[model samples]
Target: MSAHRMSDPLDRRRFLTAAALRGATVVGTGVIGATALGAVDADAVFAAPLRRPLDPAVPAGAFVEGRITSIDGGVLEVAGSHGDYARVRVTGATSVWKVRPTTAASIETGDGLYARGVPMPDGTVAADAVWVNIVNLHTTIRGIEKTRLHLAHGSHEIVGNLLPATSSASYSGAAPTADLSGLRIGQGAQVLGAWRPSDDSVDIVRVAVGPGAGHRR
Candidate 1:
């Protein structure tokens, strides 16, 4: 067999480094601070330390924040909430999270996403990390059941599904734990998790109650 040509178009090494760097999130820190991508050096931005403080900056450039409209192999067509569109290319090195750390195969059309990566010459974003159906909401627990929690966010009520093995809690600035005993009804909390499109419910990653709830980082 002939020797393979060393002319692969994509630089996998650099992309790997970016993925490794961006994957760092402090334990129990669910919120992400996305700064403007235009002025940032693409090489360093992915390696940049994610600040703990919460800032709602929408990462521009090759970053896509929206719902997946279509999937063609590893390519995802996304429709942004704001009248924008993006095409994201997922690869083996891409880190995916849907409720938990998962793989690209778990992504489906209609799943909401936030993908950040470098832009190829063809205008497709080569994703480093993709978070599917992820939502971080600040709500007050109105009611609690064995498997679900009724939450009130402003005037909208939401049903938060609790997974016995997956759902967790962080109480009063403590680290995350599987215990739900401390959660009190009517307590203000932050729910971070994946949204279930079929039922409009959330499979919670964890419910945070304490001095560190909400967008307090």
Candidate 2:
């Protein structure tokens, strides 16, 4: 985000509001996890499959994806699947998201990491953003039974398990709510949560339904 973008809060609010409205009718990928602040970013994350492509002005080496094998001080040793490796350094300014906005202390070894940052002189990635164990996807509500939501992701139907203790829903860019009465069958939604590799299911943390999804009083 540039300074001009942050100069006015309304800019983001308005943009997100429009984004929410646009997302309401569209199903997209989810990046799981709920934020007390809300779902505007959740809606914007995948506003469109390729709405705003990555900015080329940013340096090329600003991304690092791998598994955390070790944490020494503020740095994490990452091993990529393709025989690649990297050293990621987390700083105070770094925004860490592990189920929620957290700190480096919450990060653990063996957790997956996808970082966006600058390259340091020491060949380390000076991370500005870090997400641990996060999965973002677009899904449509197929069915809902109790705490479970059957979602259709592309051609596959996967169950979205809502964790009552931590799961939340964001409506029309509003703050997160424990009440999930907003979710309706056949509605498109964005989900941010953890992916259960064991069963190919998802443990939903935060769900974002666009403006047309309706508002609950």
Candidates' TM-scores? 0.72, 0.58
* Candidate-wise lDDT, in order: 0.71, 0.66
Model 1: per-residue Cα lDDT over 1-217, one tens digit each: 0122134333333543343345422222222222222222333434542222121232233578999999876678999999999988775456577887655667888999998776655677767677899999999999999999999989999999999799999988789999998899989999999999988999989999986335464
**Model 1 bad stretches (over 4 Å):** 1-13, 16-61, 211-217
| Candidate number of the best TM-score | 1
**Residue 110 miss distance in model 2 (angstroms):** 3.1
What tens digits encode model 2's per-residue C-alpha lDDT throughout 10-43? 3322332233323221211132222224433433
Worst lDDT window (10 residues) for model 2? 24-33
Whole-structure CA lDDT of model 1: 0.71
> Which residue ranges in model 2 land beyond 4 Å of their true spot?
1-61, 81-83, 171-176, 196-201, 210-217
Q: How does model 2 score by TM-score? A: 0.58
